[model samples]
Target chain A: MKNTILIMGHKSPDTDSICAAIAYAELKKTLGFDAKPVRLGKLNRETKYILGYFKIEEPELVTKIIEPQSEDMKQDIILVDHNEKTQTIDEADNANIIEVIDHHRIVFNTANPLYYRAEPVGSTSTIVAKIYKENGITPTKEMAGLMLSAILSDTVIFKSPTCTEEDINIAKELEKIAEVSIETYGKDMIIAGASIEGEDLADVVKTDIKLFEFGTKRLLVSQVTTAGVNKLLETKNQIIEVLEKIMKEENVDGVVLMLTDIVLEGSELLSVGKYASLIGVGFNAKVGADSVFLPGVLSRKKQIIPKLTEILI
Target chain B: MKNTILIMGHKSPDTDSICAAIAYAELKKTLGFDAKPVRLGKLNRETKYILGYFKIEEPELVTKIIEPQSEDMKQDIILVDHNEKTQTIDEADNANIIEVIDHHRIVFNTANPLYYRAEPVGSTSTIVAKIYKENGITPTKEMAGLMLSAILSDTVIFKSPTCTEEDINIAKELEKIAEVSIETYGKDMIIAGASIEGEDLADVVKTDIKLFEFGTKRLLVSQVTTAGVNKLLETKNQIIEVLEKIMKEENVDGVVLMLTDIVLEGSELLSVGKYASLIGVGFNAKVGADSVFLPGVLSRKKQIIPKLTEILI
Candidate 1:
C-alpha cells in the first residue's frame, strides 16, 4: 500500500482549518500526491453543516499521525492553518512537515527545507484557493463550495479586519464559482452556526477555544455564537464556574468566553481572574455585574486577540 | 514642510535590518513616498563595513519616532525587518503605522487596516529586494551591493537553513549587478565582522544581545563572533559575572553568550543559570568548565534559537 500523506489543521478545528485541509488535499491529489484530509478533533456543527451542505465526504478524525515504517518521511505531513506545535497533534513534532499553508504567526521550522507559504490573510482556504489558481488546476465544484464557505466563514462575510483585499477579491470570484449569493448565503450560514442547541453549557462554551501566549500570560479564549443572545447569558453562572475549572486545569493565566450574537451583531464577554480591566481597556466594552457586552465586534482574530495582546504583552 | 515617513528595523539592528531599511526606503522613494531610512541603534561593524563598501550613506540615527502634529497620521511610521513592539522604537506603539514589510512572526496590529507583507525568509533584505523587483524598480549598483551583503550576512553565505532557493537565486542576480564574487566577499565580510576590537568584555557580550521570552521563562542570548576563539574565552569569567547581573536586572531566567568563531565555524557556549541542561540537550555540546564548544555551527538564527525554543518553550 502506498503511504498516505495526511493534510491536517490544528486541534479545535475551525471552519478554515477543516476546509483548508479538505481543499488542499484535493489540490495535492490533482498534483499527483496520495493525500488525505484529516481532522484533529470532532467536527463542530458549522463544519458538519458545511460538509453536509457540500456533499463532500467528512475527513477522517484523527488524534495523531502514525510514524512512517520506512524512510520516506517527507510524505508524512502537510500542516495547514497553524504552525505552532502546541496547537498541533502529538506526533507533529516528529513528522516531516513538507508544507505549511497558514495565516497565523510563524513558529515551526524543519530540518529539511519545505514549501512554506504563510500569509497574513483571514483564512487558510484563501491560500489554498490561491495555490489552486497558481497551479492552473481548477478545483472541483464541491472543492470550490467548500473553499468558498471556509473563506466566508472565517472572514465573517468580509467584516473581519483580518480580511485583505486579496481575500475579498478571491471570495468574490469564489462566490461565483460556488453559485451562492454571498450576502444572503453568508447570513444564513452564520445564523445556522449561531443556532446552538442540545449541548451542555460547558461543552458549548469550550466549542471553539484557542490558546494564545504573549510572554508569561497564557490565555484561553473560547467563543460560542447564538442567535438568541439572552438565552446563552441566562446560564452565565455555570459557564463561569466551568471556566474557572478550565483555567486551573490548563495552568493558564486566564480563561474567557465570547458569547457572540450573530443576529444581534455583538458579543458578551465572560472572563475570570486579573484580566478584566485589561479586557475593559482592550475591548472598549462596558463592564456590568459579571460580564461585558461588545458591540459591532465580529472577529476574535483581529479585534479581541490583538487588543488583548497589546495591553497584556 | 512635507511630512517624512520613517523606515527602520528593530533596535540592535543587524546587517539585514540596517540594509533592509536602506533598500526598502529606496524602493518606497522610487514609488514616490516621502520616505527616509533611519536606524534605531548604532550600526555594527559588518553593517558599517557594508555601507562603506557600497559608498551608500548610512541612515540617520533615530531613537524615537515623533508624534504627528496634524491630520496625516498614516505617514508617520513604516516598519521593516521586524514587527514586534519590543524590538521597535518607543513611539511606534502610539504612531500611525502606514505599512510593514517583515520576515518575522506577526505580533503587531493597527487600529486602521494597513498594508502588511510578511514572508518567512532568511532576511528582510531578501523581501525588500523582491519588493523592488515586484514594483519594476531597478536598484542602483550600490543599492544592489548593499542588499547582497545583507543577504549573505543574514544567511551566513547560504549555509543557514533559513536561506531559500529564492535567496540564492536573488543573490546570484545581485552579484552580477554588484560586480563582486560571492565567495570572496562573503568570507571577507564575515572575517571583518569577527574582528572585534576596542570593546570591553561586557560590551562585547552585549553588542548583539536580544531578549527572547518563552512565556514566563525569559532568556537573553548574546552572540559575538571572533577569528580567535581564545581571545573571547580569556574573559569568560568576567562575562559570566556581568551576564548574571544583567539577567537579574532584566528579570530574565537565563543568560547565555555564543562566542562563535567565523573561520573555525563553531561556537563556544558560555551560560549562567538553570538553562544549561536545556542548552546541553539543545546543542548536544559537552558542558565543560563554564562553557561548551560545538563544532560546525555557523548560523545562530537556525541552529541556536530554534533548539533553545524547543527546550525552553
Candidate 2:
C-alpha cells in the first residue's frame, strides 16, 4: 500500500474527479507502475450508482495528505481535476508531485520539472480517456461507461456551455465502446445525482465547492445540479448559513452557492461574504435577501467563474 | 491564413522541437483546426538531413513573435518543446497562448486558462506522437521518421539518462511505422549531425546552447555531440572568445560549452565567466587553459547541469 502510487483528485470529489483518478491509475498500472486510485471525499449518489453499475469497488477515502517521512518523501503524486493548494490536501505541497492532469486554470509552479496535462475541456476524464487511447490501451467496457458518465455529469449532458466539440466527439466514441445511448444514459446519469432528498442542506451546499484565486482575492463557489431549483429554494436560509460558515473558515472574500436546475438550464445563487454583491454587479441583476436567478448559466467553470473573474478581478 | 494557428517550438530549435511542432500541428489540423508548423530558428545539419530524408518541407522561420491587432488577438498560439520566456519568442508573452506542450520546467503562468501538456521525457515529439494516437490519426511515414529521429537525437540513441522506457517503446513503434531498422537508422541519424566541418566556431557553440536558471542565477550551457572531442578542443581559444561574448550579450552569470564525444561517452568542458572553477569543484577535475574532461558523462540534462547546479547554486 505504501509503495503503490496513490492517484486522486481535489476535495469534494465529483464524478469527473473520481473516474479520472481511477482511469489514470489504470493507465499507469498498464504501463507497469504499481498504482491505486483514492478519493479525497466520499462518493456521491451519482458516482456510487455509476460504480455499482460497472461493478467496480469505490476508491479508498483519503481526507488528509499524509505527512512525508524521509523515505516516504520519494513517493510520487499525480493530481487530477484541480491544481490549487487550497483545493488539494495540505501535504501535497511536500510530496514529489510527478504529474498533474487537470481542467482548471493553473496556479501552481515548481522549480523542478514535472509532467502536467491541463486541458480546458468539460471533464478531466475526457483527457484521461485520450491518454488511454494515446498509449494504445483500450479501456474495458466498464471503464468506458464510467468515463462516459463522468463526461455527462461535468458537462451537464451537453447542456452546459463548457461542452466542446472534442468532449462530444470523445463521448460519442466512448458511448459505442460502453454500449450506452447518449440521450437516455446521459440524462439518466445526471438526474440520478440531482436527487437531494436524503441529504443535509449543508452537505448539499458543500458537495462541489471550489476555491478560486485571482490576484489577492479568493472566493469559494459551491454548485449542485438538481432537477428543479424550487426544491432547493425551500431551505435557502439554511444553505446560506452553511455557505457563510465555510466562507469564514476558509477566509475567502466571497461565497456563492449555486443550485443549478438541469431541466430549467439555470441556477439560483445564494451568498454572503465581503464582496457578495459583486455577483449582482457582474450578472446585471439585483440580489434578493437570499438568492438571485441566473438564467442559462449552468457551469461553474465556464459561465460563473469566468464572468465573476472578469468583473471582480 | 489569418485564422491558421501558428505552431512553433523554442528559439535555437532542435530536431525534437521542429518535429514536435510539425507533428502537433498535423494532429490539430486532422481535428479540423487551421494549423501550420513554424520554426523559430534555421535548421541545423541534423534536422535538415532528417527532413530531407523524409522529403518534408522546412517550416517557415519566425525570428520574432509578431504583435497581433485588436481582432487578431483571438488568434490562438500553441507553443511546443519550451515554455520559458527566455526560450520562447518575445511576442509570445503578449499573444493568446492557448496551449503549451513542453518537456522542460514550467515558468510560464497565465491569468486566463489554457491547455498545457508537459512530460518529463527525452523529446517533445514523443508527446506529440501520443497525441496522434489519441486523436486516432495515423502519422504519415515522413512524420513517423521525423519523430523517431528526434527521439534518437535528443536521447543520444538511448544512451542518455533522459531516455525512459516510454521513449524507447515509442521509438520502437515508430520504427515499424517508418519501415526503418532502429539500430541502423539511429546510428546513421546521429552520425549525420556530428559533421562540423567548415562550420563557424561561434555557430557550433551557439547552435545548442540552452539557458538554465536556479533562483536568480542564470547560466547558458552549450552542448554538441561529436565522434571525437579532439576537434572542438583544438580550437579552444577561439571558442572561449565566443563564449565570453555570449555571456556579456545574453547577460547571463556564466557559460559552459560541452563537446560530448559519442564514441568515448564523455564531454570536454570549456568555461568562461563567474564561478568558473566550480566545475572542477563539482567534478574534481583539473582545468587547464580553457577545458576539462568529464569521463563517462553523456548527457547535459542529466550529467552536466544538475552536478554543476548542486555545487554552484
Best by TM-score: 2
* Reference-based TM-score, model 1: 0.59
DockQ of each: 0.05, 0.61
- Taking chain B only, the TM-score of every model is 0.88, 0.87
Docking class of 1: incorrect
lDDT for model 2: 0.83
**TM-scores for every candidate against the unseen true structure:** 0.59, 0.85
| Model 1: lDDT to the true structure | 0.80
In order, candidate lDDTs are 0.80, 0.83
Worst 10 residues of 2 chain A by lDDT: A281-290
iRMSD per prediction, in order: 7.1, 1.3
lDDT by residue for model 2 over B104-178, one digit each (tens)? Answer: 887876766679989898889888887787667889888899899898888888888888898999899899999
Model 1 Cα lDDT, one tens digit per residue, B136-228: 678888889888998898777887667889889889988999889999998888778877677566777788888888767888988887778
